[model samples]
Every structure is written in structure tokens, then in C-alpha cells.
Target: MAISGPSPFLRYGVRIANEAHTSLDEAAETLGLLGYAVVDSGLDADQLEALRARFNAIHAANHASTDVERLRAIGEVDLLRCPLADDPLFLALASNPRILELCERLMGAGFILNQQNGIVNPAGAKTYSQSAYHRDLPYQHFVSTRPLAINALFCLDPFTLDNGATFVIPASHKQEAFPSDPVIAAQAKQIAAPAGSFLVLDCMVYHCGGTNRSAADRRAVNHVYTIAMMRQQIDLPAYLGDDFSTDPKIRQLLGFNHPTARSVEEFISQRKAK
Candidate 1:
């Protein structure tokens, strides 16, 4: 008799159910095993509506100035560093207690906010920028027992198979080797969550956005969180400077006042004190 591997489909379903029921610890365990987790109805109705509206307004304003040729080629627009950055609602959503707890489970405390970008995938786009299966972080030869980074994709609109829902290769994060095209194609699973759902993923997972073939734009925002020891994709502290809120959680998420020695002398002093 031989032992068999877990079924990706069944495993993911169980994980999603776990997250939906607020069994965060179980969901985190599943995420560690499968590389992804889906939390249904993570946001309230009013919160979802507000996020959608704010995203729409900002997208329309910025897209008006975008080069048509670039838009045509890309078929998508990512509003990098969302204008609603200052909005406590967006900040709260990004660092939602549940999400933070899940992240902390894998990455430990002092997770830094790495990115927040609103994505709009228009229908019938000739070339979807993120259609290729790839990892979020730059390729490295090594892997970590603990996750270095994680993502939270908040769905502002229905994520349908035909509307650019994300595709992921289950358990790919555990593999130290880069996935070949054939491997990715064979194992990829397209995920469709309802509006207001939150999809969390390990950053090392092989994943991609599906092509949009629907009539309307598929909207979502991505919030990336990483271990505080990792370098931020964007210099958030520099950008925000003194303008950001004084909220402790917000400050922590933004990587402000993270415990660190500024120099060798400081490190020596702190060590002596300890």
C-alpha cells in the first residue's frame, strides 16, 4: 500500500471554509500547506461599496491622462499607491485584525506593509500584464520555513472565471524549484470569489491573474505584507514621512519604529544593556 498526496481541490475548499468560519488558525495551517486561502465576505457591505467608489473615481481621473497606446497594449491599469492611502478605512482594511493575525501566524509579528495598488482589468484585453504564472517576489535560489511575505487581494467586484479571477498553482510555494510551463498549466486552479471576498496568498506561490473576457471591468485591490526584516518594495516611511496617522497599528504596519540598532555602536550598547 502506498500513501497518496492531498487533493488540491478538496484541500483548498476546506481551507476556504475554514477561513469563512473564522477558524483563522486552521486557515493559516491550510495556507502553509496549500499556499493560499480565501475568506468569503471579509468586508461589510458599506465598506465594500466605499472602496469600489473610491477606486472608480481615482481610476477614472488617472486613466484620463494615461497614454492610450500603453493602455491598449497592457489592457489593464494599476493605480499604484492608491489615493485613498490616507483614508483610515483603507488602512484598516489592509491591516484588518483577522488578516494581520493570519499574516502574523506565518511571518511572525512586525509585518511591514509592502504594497497597496488598485487593479482594473478591462474586458477583451489583448494582453493581460499579469497573465503569466509567477511568484510575487524576485526569484531566489532559497526558500524559508516561515513565509517572508503574503498578499491580501480585496475583491471590489465579482471575481468570475471569465472576468480575470486569479489562477494559482496549489502547493507551489513549498517547491524549491521554479515551475515549468507544463507544470503550471497542468496544476493551475482558477479562483472565483464573490465581491467583498478576501484572497490571501503566500508570496512565493506560482500564481497569475486570469484573462478577462467579460463585458465589464474586473476590479480589485492588492495589499502586500512582508516580514519587517525584508526590504520594502516601496520606501513607505520616506513617502509618508510625518503625514501618516499616529495610530500604533498603522505605524507598525507601515514599518515605523521597528526595533533595530541604527549602528554597530548602538547594537553593542543594546546588547550590553540586555
Candidate 2:
């Protein structure tokens, strides 16, 4: 059987959650129990469907074939340019107000819009070693002792275990590092969200994109926001930095107003401070 207890990752936030209510309260509660929270929104189903179409079109053209290579031994690929943000249909998701406030509370007062990615998992892609059991922390250039990293997934289509939905090990963020021998497969009770429903995960949790055994492609928009220390997996500040502060949606993610100093060099400074 799998070992179980309060995940070391969620210890602090969960404490803060039990003390409050509302979305803020829920966030604290997630920290206490699950190590993350899904803030509800009215970004709506239509918006998500439209965004999906926009992504599928771009996804088709972005490649000569829909066949994209993935590290399937670990199960999935984190594709950075999915074109959802560029599509007008995705405007609401790119700029949701509730998510912005949550970013400020969890990441920091000067958080950064770390990365915006689109994930595509093909049918029958292998699982297990593909993603391996890991926390989202290993790749950080800058980080905090306190958890300040957050990733949100916009399920463009319904997410299910049979076809690859993102999976997590309850609250696993508290671990200093990821498990090398974590042999359990992703829980079947995965994040099966409706279209437009967004699920957020604390970067500390052990997670990976599950295998897609069905023919339909499993797609999602992954938007991650972080404290100043973490280097984004994408060229964030360069692409979105100038308009980040003034862009109301982006601003909420930043906890910061101006992001003129964003660069890899900035990441080094952040790493040093920690």
C-alpha cells in the first residue's frame, strides 16, 4: 500500500486555510489538507470551447503533423506555445480576477507570471517513468522556504484518468525533494473538471500528466505564477513582461505592477537572496 500522512508540502497553507472561509479561506484549507485549491470562476463554458478551437487550429498549423514527440517514458510533454493566450476567446482566462488575487496571497506581493503553457497528451502514451513522481520545485532558479509557487490548469475538455488529466498525491509539496521510488500510479479520482473549470496546484505536490489511452487528444492550458525567485520555463518577461503590470489580468498574477527587470539575470539575484 502507498504510505500516507499529512504531506510535508502542505503543512503551512493548510494551517492558514482552516482559519478562514470564502475563496481565501478555501485556499488556506487547501494548504492544510490537499496542498492546493481550485478557485471557482465565471470565465464560462463558451469561452473555454472557443479557446479550445483556437488552440486546436494553432496546434494543427504549428506542426506538419499532429504527432508531437513526448518523453512518454515519463508520460507527457509541457508544450509552451499553445496559442491560447493569443486567441481572443481566451481573454477571460488570461485575465480572471479571482485568480489574480489568489496569486498575490499565495506567491507574494511581487509575484511573477512565470509561464503560460499548453499541454497535449496523446492516446496510449506510456505512463510511469514518463513523468516520474516529482514536485515542481527541482527546476527553480529562485525559490522561497515558504511555498510561493502556483500552477493553474484550464481543462479545455473534460479531464479524466482514462485519457490523461493532471494528477497529484494529495498534499506532497512539503517534501524537500521528490520521491525516487514513488511507485503508485496517478489516482483514478483525477481532476476531472468541466470545460472552463480551473484547478490550481501548489508547486510542492507530487504530480504528472497521466497517460491518454483514448483517441481524442487531452488538452489543457497551464498558467503558472510564482514569487520573484523562480525562473519561468518560458520567456515570460520578454514576451509578456512589458504589458504584464498594466494588463489587469496579468497584474493580478504579478502582485507586482512593473516587470521591466525580468530576465534570467534577475533569476540569479533571486536565487542569491534565498
Query: How well does each candidate superpose onto the true structure, as a TM-score?
Result: 0.81, 0.71
Number of colliding residue pairs in model 2: 16
| Model 1: residues with Cα > 4 Å off, grouped in runs | 1-22, 65-76, 84-86, 259-274
Report the C-alpha lDDT of model 1 over 210-265, residue by residue, as the tens digit.
88998888888888899888777667777777558688778888877554677999
Q: Which candidate has the top score in TM-score?
A: 1
RMSD of candidate 1 to true structure, Å = 6.3
Cα lDDT, all candidates: 0.77, 0.62
Model 2 lDDT at residue 21: 32
